[model samples]
Each structure stands twice: as C-alpha cells, then as structure tokens.
Target: MTRTTVTARPAEPSVVARLSALDRWLAVWILLAMALGLGLGRAVPGLNDVLAKVEIGGISLPIAVGLLIMMYPVLAKVRYDRLDAVTSDKKLLVSSLVINWLVGPAVMFALAWLFLPDLPEYRTGLIIVGLARCIAMVIIWNDLACGDREAAAVLVALNSVFQVLAFGLLGWFYLDLLPGRLGLGDGQHLDVPMAKIALNVVVFLGIPLIAGFLTRRIGERRMGRDAYEAKFLPRIGPWALHGLLFTIVVLFALQGKTITSQPLDVARIALPLLVYFALMWFGTFALGKVIGLAYDRTATLAFTAAGNNFELAIAVAIATFGVTSGQALSGVVGPLIEVPVLVGLVYVSLAWRRKFAVRGRA
Candidate 1:
C-alpha cells in the first residue's frame, strides 16, 4: 500500500487567484506608494531626517528591516530543491549566468560612461544598478509572460548566490580600478568595501535564504509539500509585496526634497536605465531564439536577465554611499523607472509569444 499526503483544499476563489491579480496592478501601487512617500516627506519636514537618524553601520534600521522583509519571502519561494534540476539544461543555465553576471554589467558600465560621462555620481549609481541582477520582480514578469516558473526560480536562486559573492569585487573593478586604468573621468574613486558587501549579503540574502530553506523544509515535513506550497507559500507571499510598497515609500520619503528640486537629475539617472533594460531584454530574447531555445526557456532567460534587484541595490547605496549621496539617489530612482518599463516588457513578451510561436526546451 502507498502512503498518501493530505493537502489544503482550494477555496472557490483561491488565495493564489487573488494574489495573482496583485502583480498586474503592481505598477499602480508603486506609483501610489511613490506619491504618498514623496508627499509625506515634503509635508512632514523632519520625518525623513528622523528616520535617517536611527541607524547602525550607516544603514537606517527601519529601512534595513523593510529591505529584509522585501527580500526573504521572494528568496524563500525560489525552488532551491529544483536548482540542480536546472543544470540539466546547461546551455540555458550557462547563458543566463554569463549574461546576468558579465554581459549585463559590461553594458551598463559602457552605457553609463557613454551617456553620463560628466556626471560621476550618477554614473557610479547606474553601474551599481547594473551590477545588481533581479531577484524578485522577474518572478512576476516570468509569470506574466507564461515562462517556465521553475526555471525562473532556479535562476533567481543562483543569481542571489552569485550577487552575494561578486557584487563588491565587481564594484571595485568597474567603478574604481578599471576606470583609473581606462581613464574614465577620474574613475569616481568610489570606495565600496568587500566587508560591507559581505555584510549586506549575510544580512539580506544569507539570513533569508537560510530562514526560507529551514521554514520550507520544516513546513513540508510537518504539513506535506502540497499543503506547504498551497497554504503556506501564499500566506507568506504577500510579505514581499507589502514590504516592497513600504520600501518605495520610505525611499522616496528620504529623497523627496532632492528629487523634487532636481527633476532633470532624475531624468539623467533614468536615461541609462531605460537603455539598459531594453538592451538586456531584447538582446537576451534574440540570443535565446538564435540558440534555438524554446519559448518558455527563452522567456525565462530574457526576463531573468532584464530585471534588477533594486531593493538590494537601494539598501547598499544608502549604506555604502550616503543617504543624500548621488549614488543613493540613483538607487532610489531605479524602481521608479524599472516598474513601468518592466510592465511594458511584459506586454511585449506576450505579443512576441503570439508572433513567433517558437517551441523547444533550452
């Protein structure tokens, strides 16, 4: 006789259905959050200052908590158990890892230097954004595009691990050492310490990955996989969304004065970003097709490569650079540009799916 597992029953309108709609409406919420954050910052006067004052290691305590909350739920949902399975598709995995870690950063670096050569601060900020790959929102984008969700989860987990290991060293090379050698406008001399990078990884990625893995394993063991995926996952899913909204509010609140004062500055920061997103998405999509990857695998690679982990980038900007620094400002502007742009890409992906209609596994 075979042992059977008990699972949660679905409601007439399941939690997944309700939450699924949230991703579609995320841009609206993000805009609203930005407005509310900016409004509160402008109206309250000292509120942002007060928030900035409560800090340790140059990181605001409240913002740190919000960032962690934003990250953990997303990381937890990544099918780490399925990570090895992704390796079976070596071409897809290798292409994604190489593009995300290498080509992505190089493009952003050149674009920043090309577009904002005179503005070192914004240049550095853009480079930092480029270095940080997507960990959360790509999941939504992947779902919207009807890509391989399992593949997306596996790539996300891999990127998260790689970022923790490479971000600091990359930052040093691109923003600091390489610039001096190449003579890119005094090299910016940005001081991004490996220790700081390592600390952030431990705090933002490590804690969450460990916690997520433990919780998932224990939950599945106690309640069974079906129940855990259905009941438990949905329950915790909203944490990332809520935390994201709260974080956007806090970020804009902190920079409301500067943002309102220098509107063109925001545009300058956004310029390279828009180009970066388009290039990454289309480049990867075309490459996927050229390599004869299936629609699902191609979509997965495109979305994964296109998205940026702005939450981690923002936190790092504030901590490593200063709350009021241009680096921090660029980080703040990332989501403002990213949400609308990526949402647009979702539609484009849908259209492409209809147009080409190619099919093959990576």
Candidate 2:
C-alpha cells in the first residue's frame, strides 16, 4: 500500500529528429541549389566557360575540388581500423559484386535500349554511367542514411579497384560487343582508354582517401578516439554538405542552358534514369533484407549499388565523344536526376530504420 510512484523512461527522439537543422532540410536545400545553378547558368553569360577553364583530366577543377571536400569529411569519419570485419563478410562482398557488376549494368543497358532506342548517344551514355559504379558521392548518401560507415568505406574501396580493372572491359562489352550480339549496334563503338579511367580513380578516390586516412590517424594519435570522434569530427562534418551543395550548384549551372533549351531530350534521358535508380535501390535494399543484413549494412549496400560515378561517366563521355555530343549531355543529366532521387531514398531509408527499431523492440 506504500506503493511507489514509478517513472517511465522517455522514448528516444527519432533519427530524423536527431539531425541538425541543415541535415533535416537537406532535400529542400538540394532543390534550391539546383534552381540556383540553373538560374545562374541561364542568367550569366560565359559562366560555363569560366568554370571550364580549370580542368583536371577532363573534369572541371572546381567540381573536382568540391568532390574532394565533400568526400573527405565522411571518409575521415570512417573507422578504418574496423574494415577487417567488413571484408570478412563474404556475403556482403559477393552480393555487392554480383549486383554491381552483373545486374546493374545489364539493367541499365536494357532500360537505355528500351527507353531511348532512337537516341543512341544517350543510350550509350547511360550504359557508361552504369558501368562506372559509385565511388565518390555514395559515401555521403550512405552516411546520411545512417549506414555502417566502415562497411561503406570497404565497399567503396572495393569498387574503386573493380572500376579500374573492369570499367574499360565492361564498356567495350556493353557498348560494342553485347550490342553487336543483340543486332542492336549501329556500327558505333565506344573505346574508353584504361589510362584515363585509372587516372580518374587515382585522383578522385585516392587523393581524398589518403588524406582522410592520414587525418584520422594523426587526429586519433594526438587527441584520442573519443575526442577525435566527438569534438574534432563535429567541427568538420558540415563541410561535407557544403561541398555537396556547391558541387550541385556548379554542375547545374554548367549544364543549365542545355537542360533548359532541350526539355524534350532531357525528359527522354530522365525517364530511363529514374527507372534505373528506383529499381536498383529498392531491389538491392530488398535483397539485403532477404539475406538478413542489419539495417545499417543494408542501407550501405542499397546506396552503393544505386549511386553512380557521375564524374567518371561525364569525363569518359566528354573525352570520347566531345563535350557537345548527346553522350556528354546524358552524362550531365545523371547527377541532376540522381541527387533528388537519392535524397528521397534517404528519407525512405530512415523510415525503414524506424520500422527496424520497432521490430527489434517488439
């Protein structure tokens, strides 16, 4: 009867709620950035020319810088020392290889052919996009979706290696050999120089990866893991988003005139891309769940499989087909579509995360 008053524990705030204001309204900011870039490109004369003047292996230097800045902080956050566990997961490694190498390319090739049968350049461009896989921006997407950081790092590094070895061969197979076999070739062949692909991987993935690894090693050595993660990381985390937004603005501004002028063509290219992203993301996510992956690793797999290396795709298209070609245009249209779609997927992943938590409790 001297019964006690009991206090119930407070429920934790949801994942979305825990995000900082900048992180919370990411989709809105992305849209605004896209609009701003388009407006700048349309309103300002010679802006694209100015941005194009600085180049690193056919990629715009500003865009390259933005990518490095965008990727560095996220890579730095990864616990590199923990990657052995990720590597030991044979299921993850094998599944990723099959989906990325086999299913992803075949699906995009089919979609490109199905959607843009009349537009061969764009179709080829889409195939190139598919073969390049995701090495750069995928880390950001996976992190935002609350994925396993170490797993993402391992998978991304694995992708970079495969990209170097397989990109040219796969490009030849899809753009030349397979098309010929299917009687779909129009006598046009794509030759992606292996050296060019290797250079891109080295600059885009290697430089930042080395920088990030060194940063973490030195920071931890000096500050200890807790301080390095808790204090130092917080200071640099926002730059990742800043770099992403800046890159989006630059990309859109560069392509804004072409995008605005050729609405019909952009729409044509967009349809297949939309279908590709949705199918790849949802399909891989479902595959991960069926195979009994944790929510974090599942998200990593889904994002890695879904995102493309737009920089590599665009560079290869431009270097091979000229900047004014339809192939290049298709390449430019990639991130324009990918950014918004992946942002939506991030929300979807978070909602799924909530369900996972509920099921765990139940």
Candidate 3:
C-alpha cells in the first residue's frame, strides 16, 4: 500500500494540470470573495446597505441565487432511477446517512462545547450548523474525495428530503439549550423561522433539484451515461462554484461590519472551528473504515460528515440571535474557513486512498 502524505504531491502541478485543478482551489475563490466584500463594505458601507437589502419578505436574493446554484448540480446528479443499479451498494447509502446526520452533528456539538466554552452562542451555532446537513457541496467534496458519486447523489436527495421534515424539530431541539432573547429581539423558537427557510429550500433545493433530476434522466435516457456525465456534470461544477462565490461575496459583505468590529474574536471562533473540522474529518473517515467501507465511500462519509449546509445555520441565526450576535457570527464564520479547510481535507483523503484501498483489498 502506498501510504503517502499530501506533501509528496509535486511542488507544483503543470499548467494544464493546474487548469484541471481549478476545483481544488475553490478555497482561493471563496477567500477572494471575502476580500472583495471587505473592500466594498469598508469603502462604501452603502454598498452593504444596497446589497444586503435585495430581500423579499426578508429573505435575501443572493442567498436564494446561491441556493439554486448549489442544488442544480446536486439535483442534476441525482438519478431517481439509478438506485436500481447501485442498490447493490447499500453500505454506501447507510454509512453516509448515519455519519452525515447522526454522527456528524454529535461530533460537532462535542467539539464546540469542549473547545469553545468561552463562546456559548457561537458554540451552539456550531451545533446548529452541523444539524443543517449537506446540500450541494457534498458532491464536490465527494468527487474530490473520490467517493462513489452515485451513492453521494442518493444521499443528497435523502438529506434534502429529511432536512425539511426535521429542520424545525432539530433546530428547536438543539438550540433549546440556549435561552432566547425575545424581549431584546430574536425569536422565541429557532425553528419557527424555518417556514421562511422552507420556502427558501423549495426555491433553492426543491426547484433546481426537480429540474436537475429531470435533466439528468432525460440526458441519460437520450445520450447515455458517458456523454451525460462528460457533458453536463462537469459544467454544473463551475455553475455551483459561481453560485457559492456569489453567496460568499454577499455573506462577507453583510458580515464584514461584524467581523471588523470585534476582529480578535475571529481567532476565538476560528480556533474551535479548526478543532471541529479535524475532529469531524477524522472521526467520520475512521468510522467509515471501521465499519468496513472502502476508500471511496469512506472519503464521502468523511467529507459529508465534516461539511454543513450553513444556510440553515445562517437563517436560524438571524431568526434566533439577530444578525450581529455571537451565534450569527459563528454561522458566517463556517463558510469563511469551510472551503479552504475542506480543500486540505480533499488532499488528505486522496493521499490516504492507497492505504485504505490496500486494507479494503485485504
């Protein structure tokens, strides 16, 4: 088994290789969005004033756009009928669901409480974020993780279905630990805002999801697997990135004032997030392996378990804690570090693939 570290990768990939490596650097794009937002927000607070308010009944358009963009590729990948083919791979489906919804959230809560006792609201925010589950990016992470993509698709569908039914319940249940400040502003029930959140999901996760599924089925029915995958799925990746970028820009712009006001708190929030990421990545990865999943499925479990929707986190934060509270702050913090952190993890997953493959083969 080739148990190599990511450092063993060439100090630089070739230009063509680097061109091919665009997805690997999604973190850089997200960071650049952060910088652009900071510049715009600081230079013209009016810019934030204008951009932040492109809202409807209170929901932000950019976030809606992001939701559509995030789910399109995911829904595109979903093959309602493909399960007939991969039903043989039940282990992948079962492990992904267990790790993603159950184990992942629990690990996040533990990590948050243990490492971030000083920031209770944000710590609880982490728990809230974890409970939100995966939407679109899990596909990118699974692809990067070299996971069984079909299995990942199935799980995404399952997650979207389950999140809506359970979001309100989980939101109220998880954040029940933290007291609400209804007199000061925030809502009494964290999940109550999910009615708005559910509309966003239907607009975001539901519409594109249905469209993507239809498109995938038609494309596959007409052009067959190789052509559809080669033609459509790859294109969807860029769209997803653009959507995420748009979301990232607006997020940083809206949150820039908060981030700047108490800059040192960035470290305090980020530290526990770092700890959270490590715990999640390894914990899920190890759990998958111990349960006897292979390299690909194991990687998917690891990534899905580690990634959070943050959409729900942000929404609930606004509803429960207002835009500037520590909880809301932590919700925004999830994305700032998410792409970069997960990119590092993709490499780790790839590096460890050989060793895990050997074990699987054994």
Q: Highest lDDT, which number? A: 2
User: TM per model?
Assistant: 0.81, 0.95, 0.81
Better of 1 and 3 by lDDT: 1
lDDT of 2 by residue, 149-217 (tens): 888988988998999899988888888888888898643566777788888888778998999999999
Runs of candidate 2 exceeding 4 Å displacement:
1-12
Residue-level lDDT of model 3, residues 242-305, one tens digit each, is 7767877777787777777777777777877887788888987888778676666677667877
Task: Give the C-alpha lDDT of model 3.
Answer: 0.70
Where's the lowest-lDDT run of ten residues in candidate 2?
A: 1-10
lDDT of 3 at 302: 79
Instruction: Give per-residue CA lDDT, model 1, range 33-116, as digits (tens).
Output: 889988888888798888778876655677667767876676566666765655688788899999999999999999989999
How many clashing pairs in candidate 1?
A: 1
What lDDT would each prediction earn against the true structure?
0.76, 0.88, 0.70
Arranged by TM-score with the best first, the candidates are: 2, 3, 1
